[model samples]
Target: MPSKSPAQAALEKADKKANSSSGWFSSSSSKYEEAGDLYQQAANLFKMEKLFREAGDAHAREAECREKCQESNEAAQAWWNAAKAYKRGHPDLAIQALSQTITHLTKAGRFRQAADREKEIGQIYLQELNDLRKACESYERAGEWYAQEDAQATANACFKDAADLHADLEEYPQAIARYEQVADGSLSSALTKYSVKEYWLRACLCALAMGDPITAKRNLSKYSSLDTTFSSTREAKFINIITDAIEAGDMETLTAAVYEYDQVMKLDNWKTNILLKIKKGIQEEPTII
Candidate 1:
């Protein structure tokens, strides 16, 4: 028979306290509170032993106990600790823990923290799990929450992250929607209005990638109306040239335009990939007699 370690013994004691059969002597809330403390002790012991998974489990138990006691702030902190513990061993479980933390934070009216946690969740999904779909959802949620909190800068950044992921996934309509959204919001202030051109360019590129020349031309006109300076920018001219080349099925002109633009403003991998797709589409079209 193997002897129980200190953490294991502490967990057993926590379970017993949490499940006590006392009907009248002790209050349930008090029992849960005590159990939560014992669970915290167990978690600390597990962490000291470098048993990260066990520590995470113990912290999760503490969070459950805190929730039962109606201590939302404590529960949120406990869940955050659980997430950190799980992050040391299991990224997926860490994401789940962070989700619980976000829930509790939101319930406690700590939306800024919840929004920040949402971004963390998105990064984990995108970088660690390689799940762009989930990452996009998380970023979109974060953006919405940040926007509600009047943090437009952070909100736009989150939206841009989602838009980039949508573009990468070839979800052109969704990508265009987010890009235009950010561009529209950027119109309100001089500090951010300069960025509207890049956002509109990305949206225009997405429209072109969708083989919707009408929408691309319409968006170009809309952008020019929304920002009087847009018509004078290199981005607007590039979009116009690309739209024309695509309409004429002139691959050489399109390639040359992209090359010229890249010399001044380097296109990133995402834009380069989309341009390649657009080029492939042009090449695959049937030649006129």
Candidate 2:
């Protein structure tokens, strides 16, 4: 028989404490703190043993116990620790732990840290889970915090990530709305002058992809309102071609115009693929002019 490892012994001790406390009926915060300490010890042992999933669970329990005792800082710390543990073995569990961390941080009025955690959560959803919608939601939350802080550059970046994810999901109206929001934020400060025109044009592309000439026209007008000479740019010309193709239900012409635009300035593979998907969607379900 193999000797019991240190981690196994610690787990047993922690389990004993938890089981014994079940009926102790102690309302003292110290009692909960003691149990939380035991759980944390067990979690550390589990991590040393490479039992990361169990470590995460143990740490989460520790966090819960701390939270029940009104230990906000300890609860947040435990949650973050749990997230780190779970990320090694279970991405979904990591995300859940991060969510708890964000909740605790926000409750503690740590808005900047919460926002940073939200962005990390978004990246995990996007890259690890391949869940674009949830990623978009996380990014939107982060953007709200950054906006509240008047960090417009970071806020617009988060919005762009959300918009890109929405576009990836083929939620054109939502993507356009996010892009428009980015453009609006950029126009709020002269610092983002370089990006405002491109953002508006992206919004126009999304509107064209929606096969909504009215929406496309509205975006063009909105751009003019933002910057009087925006229509003179090559991006605006390409957007005009796209809108015209959309209005005429001419996907071939749309493709040709996109090709021409790419010839002059190479388009990203992602944007090109999104355009293809949009064209296919329109061809499958043609809306009236």
Candidate 3:
């Protein structure tokens, strides 16, 4: 064989480097392995050149390649750690890590793997932590993620639970907001009608208890409109007796008011509100007529 020229040798070396770089872009099993090796080589090159950003990108690329080739758990952990490091006191970092974990695990169908992490995040913000808003956000994300996986019922339940939690915290507006969403999204018409009627009646009774006859009358009117059972002559007569007692300011009329309120509460359309208000008034020593 003829001796090779220096230019030929240099060209051969350049070709070899090109082949290694091209290997990273290959998807075949053998090529994937070669890609891994090439990624490592690129990382070393970046590190040697003191190009930290490029080095990080190279490392990330290697990790991504490994993930694409069926090393999901390793990839998730790697991205999670990187996200944590990058987050270092920055909320954006935490969000990125959490989002990446969800994305990777969901794509890989590793629901169980992501579930604990999601729950961990929720607890960190909700329970042991004092960030109710953040906790709500986490729950919302979990619900959304589950929904995307075709778990509609589970997602609905989760959102409902979060709404309840918000309610329990005396976050009435938030509770009402979430409840409205739940009501709009999944509640059956029958249930929605029942809930509206029930709550309106409760409001009416509360107004009556507070001697706010105007509000009470308005709510009662609304309740009656929604529920035919409340429009009965018997219920109307009972409501009339209370109205007359209120106008009379006659404590002597309380006995009749109590009897009428109790009867109204027993009616099918009448919710538990009338009974609650009567009970509350009886406790307050000035029975609201």
Candidate 4:
């Protein structure tokens, strides 16, 4: 018979700790502590052997033991450890552990930590899982927490990320709404004053793409009336040209104006794509009146 490796030995020990953790602790609080400590030891051993799955399980066991021993904070820490252990090696288990961490942290009133987890989950959802919608929700939740903390820049950034993801998924209404929110907020900030027109332009473009003439006209009017700086700018003039063409159902005029803008600004692929979408929307419309 072949001899068991050190990893096997560690796993056996971890299994024993997990199996016997449920013993009746009739007034002896030390039992839970002993089991929790043993589980943590096994978890370290598993990690040392690169058995991340086993390590995650052991760390989770440690958390459960700590919880039963009334060590709430330690339990939360152990759960966090489990999440980290599972993060790289196990996708499903990692999210589950993160959810557990969020629950415990929220119950403990650690809003900041909870927000961090929300942001982390958002990143994982987008990068690892490729679930864009869930990622948007997670980022939006983080934005809300940041807003509560009065971190306006951070909050707006998170909101913008969520909006971008929504737009990438072609959720135009959501993108438009988020863009409008950002534009409205930017108008009130002296530091962000110069960015106001750009934000409104993005919102207007989204409206046009979605074939919402009312919204496009409203945003165009908003741009013209925003401030002296905006009303007199080249971007404001471009909006007027595009809006007039769309309102008149004149595709030729719209095309010419877009070409002019592109020639001057050298539109990036994304901007060109948005403009193409606007043109398509115009072609599909029966009449703007």
RMSD, each candidate, Å? 2.3, 3.5, 14.8, 3.6
**Which candidate leads in TM-score?**
1
RMSD of 4: 3.6
Off by over 4 Å in 3: 1-74, 77-99, 103-120, 168-171, 184-186, 189-289
- Candidate 4: lDDT over CA atoms? 0.79
Which pairs clash (backbone N, Cα, C closer than 3 Å) in model 4? none
Query: Please, what are the lDDT tens digits per residue for candidate 4 over residues 1-289?
Result: 9998665676566557546645464443566677788788888888888888988998898888788788877888888888888886586787788788888887888877777878888888888899999999999998888778777777777787787787777788898788777777777888977776766777777777787768787767766775657767777788778888888888889889988988887877656788888888777767635
- Model 1 CA deviation exceeding 4 Å by range: 1-13, 19-25
Expressed as tens digits, the lDDT of each residue in 222-243 for candidate 1 is 9899888899999999999999
TM-score of each: 0.89, 0.83, 0.37, 0.79
Q: Write the per-residue lDDT of candidate 3 for residues 1-289, one digit (tens) a residue.
A: 9986443343344335434544465545454444544555565565555554444444455556566567766567655554443333334445555666677887888775566456556755654456777777677767676667666556655665566455444454555455445544543456344444333333444455555566556656655764665655454445556656664555557566666666656544233434445445545665456
Q: Mind sharing the TM-score for model 3?
A: 0.37
Estimate, for each residue in 1-289, the C-alpha lDDT of model 2 and write its tens digit.
Answer: 9999776777677666655644566655766777789889989999888999989998998898798789999999999999999889588999999999988888888888898889989999988899888999999999999888777788889999998888778788888889888887777677887787777777777776676778888779778877887888888888888878777788789889988999997898667876776687678884656
Model 2, runs deviating above 4 Å = 18-28, 248-253, 281-289
